[model samples]
Target: MNARDPSLPLQADELSGLADFAASAWDEEIVPALTDYIAIPAKSPMFDADWAKHGYIDRVTRDAAAWVESKKVAGLKLEVIRVEGRTPVIFFEVPATKSGSTDTICLYGHLDKQPEFSGWRSDLGPWTPKYENGLLYGRGGADDGYAVYAAITAILALDKQGIPRPRCVGIIESCEESGSSDLPIYIDMLRERLGNVSLVVCLDSGAGNYDQLWLTTSLRGMVSGVLKVEVLTEGIHSGDASGLVPSSFRILRQVLDRLEDSKTGRLLPDSFHCEVPAARVAQARATAAILQDEVWKRYPWSCGADGAFTLPTTTDPVEGLLNRTWRPTLSVTGVEGFPDLGNAGNVLRPYTAFKLSLRLPPLIDGNEASLKLKTLLEDNAPYNAKVTFVPDGRAGALGATGWNTPELSPWLDQALNEASNAHFGAPLGYIGQGGTIPLMSMLQKGFPKAQMMVCGVLGPKSNAHGPNEFLHVPYGKRLTAAVAQVMAAHP
Candidate 1:
């Protein structure tokens, strides 16, 4: 982790100490500790019904708190806060050394991880941390067991260099993977202790690439639910029903066809679509130019699937980038009401079920979209077959709401460019991510004056929430340095 090559853009003492501290911490403390953390199976409450009973969540929180204590920075008070019937939060507060400074900046992340996904490379497992070829492979390394580690390391780097930092509070929660259900409660409960925040840094976001500093200007929200289609009450022989009855599966397919184009993949309903902001479109073009083929090349494209499964809009990578980040899209994330192929029989199924996940534009309302989806799916049933649309939660199952990112402060822009140019010989780049970070909206409402900065190491093929997920080691170290630079200059 400490390999220093001439290629680094370590042009300043602040950046240098930041990189060095990250390397030292990773080698001496973070890797070993994170490896143990990955082994704990700290799945979010949604995925693991027995999360509290299993105690894995609490175990990881304690481990994280212990690591912060080992840093031993002055005025560092680390607490594992447990509220009733909710996941715990690792709340660490550090007073700024800059005299008379009351500026409080919040750094947000989550230790709670997604469930172990299938299709990991042969040599890797979700619980087994493996380091090779400059990547750390394991769940939570990128999304986001590294946030607390990186946040702490950034502050300590400033400490080592005698640089003044604004008052900083790190809120590493245990419920982000569950759509941050418990985070708002804690944010409200601790509003007084949290004080006022001028700046909020969120590390639970995606970078455009690994070569330079990337900032998340906005995040896309989502609407999700299950659509069920039932034609008959009991299974029947397929041969007897083939010509006489409409297949429930076929009817379900037709319903989906109403929402999205089967060929072009464009969303069908006008209500599900929103006008993309011109500013964001311009940013996408700029980032698309910088990334070029990398926008398409980074996917594993297993077995050369890119050739066969490429999107129709692949001709213009810029459009694809916009499509991913700014445009509304739909995905059938899961399905049920059918037996596994291995256990399949000749009987016709009585019903078909599909779990839908729809990604909305950055400015769209998730509740409105959910209502549209439910109406579109259940309004007119084909052949009078029963159709049902059930939301996984209240109307907006994901509490989905996108944010129009405020303009960047001049100081933050300078810090981003300096860090980027120093480390990678490149300028800073900004892009909107397709993923949702609920805290972004909450913080905007909670502290209307705070400028939010979202950055992370989850570049393409870093594969967060997927099998073989990894944290790019070099990017992580450089990003830690970049964040330190931001903190050092926040005042």
Candidate 2:
């Protein structure tokens, strides 16, 4: 598009120029835009059923699409694609600079966010943007509202330095936090348009540390739903029902016991897990050696009365990494059927409901796992209490599937190390993330041979999806430059 010579390789000085360009863009444009973005409550459709009426999702999507167009990158075409009754996606493309090159690079990110979680520091609410000590703190900033902005910055950085890159396309969706339910529709519509993808740069992932570029080698799948157990039609006086009624809370616990081991925190179903690939286990061991005890120590632990901090389930770094990345786990995220503590009374609750979230290994099918989970929790109710387990997502698409990246090509492997050394002065790191990115699996299947550059700014203590989440701005800048370098090296 720039009419620049594509044969010339990026020199050391040019890489520096790319970094400087990315830094300037982040400071002057991207940061301010993300600050405004963080202030919007663009909750995903799953979290906000009235998302269309709320207009937050539309607002952010519109704003991001406008920003891309305003860049005025030569030969770049942008569009906000929409299907009836579905969330929007921002699709854009730039013609390849390399003459006769048909390879395409797909850049992916999402704009919607998790619901505002409690427990933020008094000064740092999810909707309030605060920039301090090179970190931008907010709800979606790290988990990845910064991705779309960073992706563009990477492309622009290459153009600014006259570095010829492969044809590039961007797909920024607004439904990722909701298991990317609407993305498949858009993908089907845009299949022919997204031609011959060879490299995928996904910014919706995590890092082992901020020192180097972290490539997410794999991701865990997820299945979430509400499990409810009801024993009575209405609440009754505790004095009258204590001895006569079987407690719904107790019955709920019994049902959960069927799924998880309380003491070890392991899922009981063998089908819910898969044997970790030997290659992944080897990578985990190498990553564990690099991270050491920080794997478990990075978490914010509470202190006990004796002045000692709470211990993690395991202190061994290898086990810690494997437990989180390769093992199936269950979490009770939310609960209902209880009154406020301040309004405590002598009443026995009629029913108890828990929002259950299950994380599955990468190879497992999420839909299959969700069905198995439902049967395990709902079959033969304890105390004959009415029980139901309704999995989230559309009927056939009841869970978010995980992805295991395809093996890196020889050139890509060298380029990753080269880019990391150029920008961060460190070699690239490989690690499996515990979170799910639904689009990755779809893209992997859609383009079976695409080399994935799944990296992001969500590093240690970023706390994505939790309170006080923040984006490490410095890391974001370096990652942008690194992406440019890799795109330039595509062969």
Candidate 3:
């Protein structure tokens, strides 16, 4: 069939055609490619220090680039760009089908997977791909490995139906799981080539549920590091040091108290806190109504002997949403200077070290917060113990800043609602994600006027970083078609 006029609005049949094309592309091509991609442990640079030496990151980047080139997209220019000491990225551009259009649509996603976490179902493994009941189970597939495929599929589907769109460009990176530390350099290098980006479709976020499209309004920033406290030069017998010397573990606990309130998960520093925007608060209230108990019930909590599951900090849905997204919290992700349970002895350990991960509010400055955290933990020491908090990453780059999306333009707003209703038979939903996407903040700074469409297939129980992660294939197909609809409606 000939391509439809660029100025004409897409009809219902056209949207259906896009869906058919996406389903075919996914089942026949995307799924097979992803299954293979999942089998290769292309862990992010953060999790795998020897990523370049291992060649997994490069392999996936090359594989994705090859797949895009094989699509034979008309006027498509593709390149696998590399900066000397960093992970590689896939960059592609397709000319606009719309006449005299200068606006650019940037599609962003990552190819890196998180570390293999424990607690998978007996039959499931991190690198083992399992397709059953319309879900693809494995790591990376949902976290963002399917992004490049879906981005290209959306454009191809639009072309198949002769739908018009602005110029499209894709930037698929391989270090997102590691906080996207290498992305800023590439963005600066490609600034001119990126053109006037007016719309951004970021597929590296999450969905509130699989029912309808969910747009991420904001993301929380993150600061991670190692906090170590030392009381003695070597281990000593507990009987000899019982009351004469201070325990390192006790000192560690005291230092952490300066940062958090043990009773509540709130960060003690006032600088970490920020006023939640009224608009976001109102949206949270509406979302709470839509999700109800789902806001807190989605977690896999352990049950007690009384046959009751563990409770969350709050049962109120609105407060739950606000707490996770807007509030600052601390977590101890890893520990060191300890022995295995089987090898533990009755000796006082010399030191205690904890890998601390602090989630900051969206409006806070990550660099400043990280600096403050280092000082808070390292400066004052109980018993004059040797304490130190070293932030992650290189000398200057410490933490990743969060992003609050720019207000949606009228055309894009209407387009999102229309696409949601047409594709999923529901209206668009807005919510904030607690996870951090470092690229969003960079893009917002670079393209201050751009409208962001941050949506993904990571829905309930489709854990991205945890075990038993899976991608909802049906929702992916609908989302691809919906993306095409939105791009076609872009003015």
lDDT of 3 by residue, 315-374 (tens): 999999999899998999889999999989999999999999999889998999999999
For candidate 1, write residues 1-491 as lDDT tens digits.
Answer: 11232223344664666778878877777767777887779999878989989999999998889989998988898888888899999888998766667889899989999999899999999999998988889999899998998899888887776677778998999988777778877888888888789999999988888889999988888876789999989989999998688899999999989999988788988876678878888888898888888887777663544556443457587887888877888888788889998989998899999988788887887767778888899988999999998765431244477776888779778878887887667899988888988788889988998988899989988999899999888888888888887776675
Model 1 gets an lDDT of: 0.83
Which residue pairs come into collision in candidate 2?
Answer: none
Query: Which residue pairs collide in model 3, if any?
Result: none
Clashes of each: 1, 0, 0
* Higher-lDDT candidate of 1 and 2: 2
lDDT of 3 at 348: 91
Q: TM-scores, in order shown? A: 0.93, 0.98, 0.98
Candidate lDDT scores, in order, read 0.83, 0.92, 0.91
By lDDT, rank the candidates, best first: 2, 3, 1
